[model samples]
Target: MWEKGYQTPIYLFNKLIGLQAVVEVVSNHTSNALELLAKQHSQMKTFVYQNQLALDYLLSECCIEIDDYKKTIRRLAAKIKKVAHVPLSKGCR
Candidate 1:
């Protein structure tokens, strides 16, 4: 690669640090499709009530976090939305 004499591992795609970053980016974007979809609060699934119920039961009953998961999901949803190109079907604040 002429004129591209030497590039650091971080600069190269799919290489060590770059690979980790790539994986993280992908993971963040695609963390739990069901959960992410629920976060969208789409009308198709009644705001994804099934997924919400399950998450509510799990987090509240299993982990004992009341309304915490909602905040967490909201945060994660925000992040996922920022990174992933998902079409939001509802208004998210």
Candidate 2:
């Protein structure tokens, strides 16, 4: 036998409304988290770009210094060759 008083339409409607409220709350939380993540990703990308530019500048400076060092060495070797009578191929006995 079905209990007529227990299976009311209004009770079922109220339950559905409560479930809808819960779903809305969960959806709002998810949206807020997604927005936060997007902002963090953007900030990370900018930081990486700045670091890359700094690294590139440092590498360029190192290359310029290395070139200057090579030139200086070449000049010194040429002066040594002019002063020494021994040929470099003979390995300075």
Best by TM-score: 2
Q: Give the TM-scores of the predictions, in the order they appear.
A: 0.29, 0.55
Judged by whole-model lDDT over C-alpha atoms, candidate 1 comes out at: 0.55
Cα lDDT over the full model 2:
0.54
Tens-digit lDDT string for candidate 1 (1-93) = 534634644345325445555666675656666465655544435445666778888788433322325456666766765665443336521
Clashing pairs for model 2 are none
Candidates' C-alpha lDDT: 0.55, 0.54
What C-alpha lDDT, on a 0 to 100 scale, does residue 44 get in candidate 2? 72
Give each model's clash number: 0, 0
Candidate 2's TM-score reads: 0.55
Name the 10 consecutive residues with the lowest summed lDDT in model 1. 61-70
* Candidate 2 lDDT over residue span 1-93, tens digit each: 437755677667667666766666665555555555555666676677667678879776422111123344444544544443223235422
Candidate number with greatest lDDT? 1
